[model samples]
Target: MYKKETRGMDIHTFATDGNQEGVLAELEKGIFVDSRNEKGYTPLACAAKSPHASVDLLRLLIDAGANIHAKVGESQRQPLALAACSGSLEKVQVLLDAGADINAESPSGYTALLHIMFRLHDNEMLLPMAEFLVQHGAVMDCESQYRESPLSAAYLRRRWDVVRFLLDAGADPSPLRWSKLLEAVALGSCHDVKELLRVPGALQQRDRFSRTPWLLAAFVGHLDKARLIHAAGIDVNEIGQCGETALMTSASIGNPEMIKWLIGVKVDLELADEFGQTALTQAVQFGHADCVEILLAAGADPSITNEYGDKPITLTTSEEVVRVLVEAGEDIGDVSTEMRRILIGLEGSSTLRVSKSEYQEGCQRRFGSSNPETMDVPFWQEMIRTGIPAYESKSQFGDLYEMTCVWCFNRFGASFTALPDGRYVQIGGEHEDYYDPDFCIYNDVVVFQGDGNFTIYGYPQEVFPPTDFHSATLVGSDIYIIGGLGYHGSRRFGTTPVYRLNCHTWHMEPVTSTGACPGWIYKHKATLSEAGNITIRGGTIAIAQDGVEDHVENNEVFQLDLTCMTWTRFAAEP
Candidate 1:
């Protein structure tokens, strides 16, 4: 029980602690039953989440006018969802009996059924509670805002029993929006895969990214499922939307077994994809020595070059792969110095370091266009590392000393916004101080997908200049980039710079604004309100006065009403 001397203890604490007597005392004292705590959980939400909560205690709170219909916290979870998530059937029954909406959705569109299967624990009541909810009219195929259904959630949790139950309960194995067969294959569920394959036309379906079940099976090293898919009549050498064959996919992922099987089945070894890379080149570039040897033994060519003029030996840094290729009559003199350095870095845990000239030249040449043919670089969209060193002054015995500090791009003040489709966008960032020779502010956008693939996008100077220390707020389908410490002579007084990048088309356009401006600001924060206003606060603005830069701390808060593209200043009240 909470002591009376412990003053300021409210009904929320009592509800959280499951103190029935303390809650009654607070109720008698006339405390608001629906008042929220710091984390936005009300008294009922607090009680619903408490493991020690009783049905009678919850009934008392509801009797005291606690709202069963209320959704609380950042997730906006209902009391029924909270009760269901806590694995308490009695609490769930209490909330449902008190008129809680069983199918009510959270902000993310998670129903009570979805919330129970979200984060799986070893609680024995979870499956029973799921069954109870399903019997009580919970939608079994209900999807969240991210299009993740309960069946997919069950597959993600690897609850085969729950999966079997959902499948037996007649959950749709083939949803039009996404493929359940491919998901089952990716998750390595043979039973679910077989069940999903029974759906008509499931074998011939392609996902939104144009990936087939055969390609996914190869990518995930699921040879068993690959054989099942092959038996289901997806030809072993069929090309995907990007002209990607299963042999190239196997080689790229370093699956020697899959490569051997594809070789045994007579897949075309020299067939180039849209990138003009054969199975041998993919194996060598990814440093798969075993796969390389297998491909070479199976009469794969090493002397052939991709569209970027990079041969199998030229793209690889592995001495083993190089030795295998050299023994197969490829000249050792063909390997470039850059590839040799990468080999040296791969010998240990040390990072692969490229000189500033090489790094800049690579970015300029490769990031010139989004088109793979136009880029003409070997490591386009591949794993890359470029470290830039910055010298920092340190105090030693009241004297300043310089030390080198290495920082990577996007490790600084870069903006990362997650897209709706399980991918994210990384915008421009700088390497070091503006005065340093290594200092470079990037004017690029890189979108990374869930499947470990990324695309680098470049823009002209006027469209989107080099940016860093800016806020990229996702408002609807557009990401608004506002305020940054750009290059010298870039920012001007009396104007707030704002640019909107469409998430779909990747097009960037500058936004013209009206009203009072927080001029030339960086290192600030911007947040979107529910009413379509972007509130920016707490940044430094620089003023150039007679060749000296004066930095002023911006204390005033500003709001941009996105509806009108107008700014308003709010002064601090004393």
Candidate 2:
């Protein structure tokens, strides 16, 4: 019978303490050999994982009927897995000779061979263990519930030595499913990709999503794999779902190497997506300046527009991009035939039910009437950098020389509200002080008359309305302003106070109703629809410099009915 003194401290405790004779004595007393500690470790498990564990102690525990396959950790690692994880070759051999399950997996589905491969910091160590396991009936494939077999898993984990060993051992040379190849490319596994390509007919395989490995590789700018795929007899011009070709994807992701390589291979340059957006349009939209230059030099037609009537130049305001397209013989300020089709197709409530003939007349009236084109030297003038106008003419335009010049733009969040008659209102935003060289902030407005002059209209001196990221939409002579960040008493806050500037009346009015405003936010886009609904969409709340988050996520699309100036949430699904 077990001694009463030994009852207080169980066999697991003896194993954890490395008391081999005490553990053997307990086994002699017929104490339950598989008894556990609070950490779910059996006595044999404690002994095997102990830093002080002896090879003889492990052998004795197995000789005493300790379940060698008993899993004993949070991940339920078997004793042999633990031995492999600990890099203990002697303990591993001892368990194997005593008939330990060499192929046993942890709760996470990692086998002894996998743990050996996983624990490896040195490849030569893994080379021996991997070879030993294969000789002892460990399955070479070693597939796991995580959807990776031993070969792909080693490849995915970047274990090249194990990967090579597994490949030499005839690891199923296929990444047969979407998840396997998806992991390979998405995680940047270039080494194993060479072997993955050797799978029978691997080039024609598509994921469940019908995306080839080439497509996914392009999706993330994985240029090495893309180059490899192109060389491996797969066409670089292959189109995936949504008509996403490799060249278009290269432009979309802004990968210069992929763009250059695809161009060198003569991939289609003018191929548009499902939405009729070309690679040039994609490059311009995402502000890839170098790609835009390359496409232009490669003879890409920079004059093309998308289905939304946005030409390559319209997608970006970069001067470099504009110069590239213009140099390629694309006129800067002209509407192409594509945009004319879009304007001619506009009807119904979208066009506010205007008659087709009248709309067509307006379209002709508006297109290319006031393009800012340059003339010959000594008469040429161009808008450059800021609002500061430059003139190259020998004589100045008549009234422009007499107009007042006000420096109106160290300003952010200001609205440039355009009018039908070619005049515009520059509404309120904060500006740095004009007097103090260091500059203070204040709320103000300016009015531009488009003949090279503007008038500064300062707000009330008693109130400094330093609104942040506000939006101003023009409706007739009145400009509606709503939802922006504000500052007062050294604290920042979101403001919902709605206001209107009546230019015709020469006064400001508090446009108020209980439901007249979307909750306060910053950086939102506001537009005046023809139906008198002022639609507000997308902006984020401001936080303090130390980042104390005090806000709500404003995701609902709101429309303020301008007739009543009442706020209402509308469905954004179109």
Please list the residue runs of candidate 1 whose C-alpha ends up more than 4 Å from where it truly belongs after superposition. 1-9, 121-126, 141-148, 155-160, 174-203, 207-211, 215-223, 230-574
Candidate 2 local Cα displacement, residue 365, angstroms: 70
Worst 10 residues of 2 by lDDT: 376-385
Error of 2 at 520 (Å): 7.7
Query: By TM-score, who's the top model here?
Result: 1
Candidate 2 overall lDDT versus native: 0.63
lDDT of 1 by residue, 264-380 (tens): 877889999888899999899889999999999999988888998777887887868877886786644356534433432412212334443443334332233432112323222
Candidate 1 RMSD computed on C-alpha atoms after optimal superposition onto the true structure: 22.6
Q: Which stretches of candidate 2 lie over 4 Å from their true place?
A: 1-33, 47-57, 63-65, 73-77, 105-110, 114-125, 142-148, 170-203, 206-228, 231-574
- The candidate scoring highest on lDDT is 1
Residue 513 alpha-carbon offset, candidate 2, angstroms: 25
